[model samples]
Target: MATRLNPYISFAGTARQAMEFYKDVFGGTLNMSTFGDMGAPVDADGIMHAMLETDSGYTIMGADTPPGMEHRAGTDMAVSLSGDDAVQLREYWDKLSASGSVQVPLEQQMWGDTFGSCTDRFGVTWMVNITG
Candidate 1:
């Protein structure tokens, strides 16, 4: 089987709620396991891991809040867009990031490609890396 990259999100004690919300939004089959199943006493009720495999061939993995961890919201993630079709992906970035904050404007960078970071209208941070 070919190797694939998937997004693994970390949540602060809300893995089940967050995964369920994602299942509602993306319409996917969610498989979850608890830490207790892994013989973790402190983390027994917490989600050890959860994965959402969507119908559109997207795989997203997430886990619940770790023991005694603090969540620094809005500072820890990036929804990345990476593909060969530079034009199409740029268009998507432009549309999704419009009316939002643009941290790094989309432009040719020193890496010999275009890259940018922006926060969407819904306050989600996104990173678009357009590779040649």
Candidate 2:
């Protein structure tokens, strides 16, 4: 499969509604997954994990609060950048993380790719994925 980049958002408990609203606005197909089915505890079943892929090639991912976790609302969004162009992505990651806090240092991950998370200088959280 080809690689892609998408936005992954976090919600308190309205992920389903939010994703649905996005579907209506963007005109896309919504695929949802409940936490419980994906190895989450029973309490997380109510939270929604969804993805919307529009016909125009837009893709968005999102998930609601996890079990035993408190939702910090406004600080819950993430910009997910992913693709097979490892060199360019790594360069971007290095530049972005140079002056910011590296929450997850860029390194070869178990999934056979380079992945990392960081909070940029502007306070926006970002995740970079470079496929191996």
Candidate 3:
């Protein structure tokens, strides 16, 4: 097995929903474990960890903030999706931007590629770039 690095997002209490939304957009298998499942003292239903592995070789992991942990917004981080497949990337952009706020509409950028950004309903930021 090779070492890999992937994004791990933190949510106040919406880890489950955010991970589910990512699965819908990316078409992947989602595995989630909650605090209760692990017999943790935190909210039983709150997600301890959720991982989405996509067919596109994208792995996204996330978790809900445990009880008593502070969740700060605008964390200066964004989950970025970049590839040469315009069609697939656009599909993801559409679904992800549907109910979220678009920071940049998907369009040709000055750098000569299709690029866009948005902050999801869960307050997680995402950037999608499709190479030309």
Q: State the weakest 10-residue window (summed lDDT) of model 1.
A: 119-128
**Candidate topping lDDT:** 3
List candidate 2 stretches off by more than 4 Å. 76-132
- Every model's TM-score: 0.60, 0.51, 0.94
How does each model score on lDDT? 0.76, 0.75, 0.89
Off by over 4 Å in 3: none
Residue 103 error, candidate 3, Å: 1.1
User: What lDDT tens digits, residue by residue, belong to model 1 across residues 22-56?
Assistant: 57655779999998988988978789899999876
Query: Whose TM-score is higher: candidate 1's or candidate 2's?
Result: 1
How would you encode candidate 2's per-residue C-alpha lDDT over 1-132 as one tens digit per residue?
799877777776778776776576457799998877677657556545788998757797888867677867537577777888787677767766776799998999998988999975545577889888
- Winner on lDDT between 1 and 3 is 3
Per lDDT, what order, best first?
A: 3, 1, 2
Winner on TM-score (1 vs 3): 3
Note the residue pairs that clash in candidate 3. Answer: none
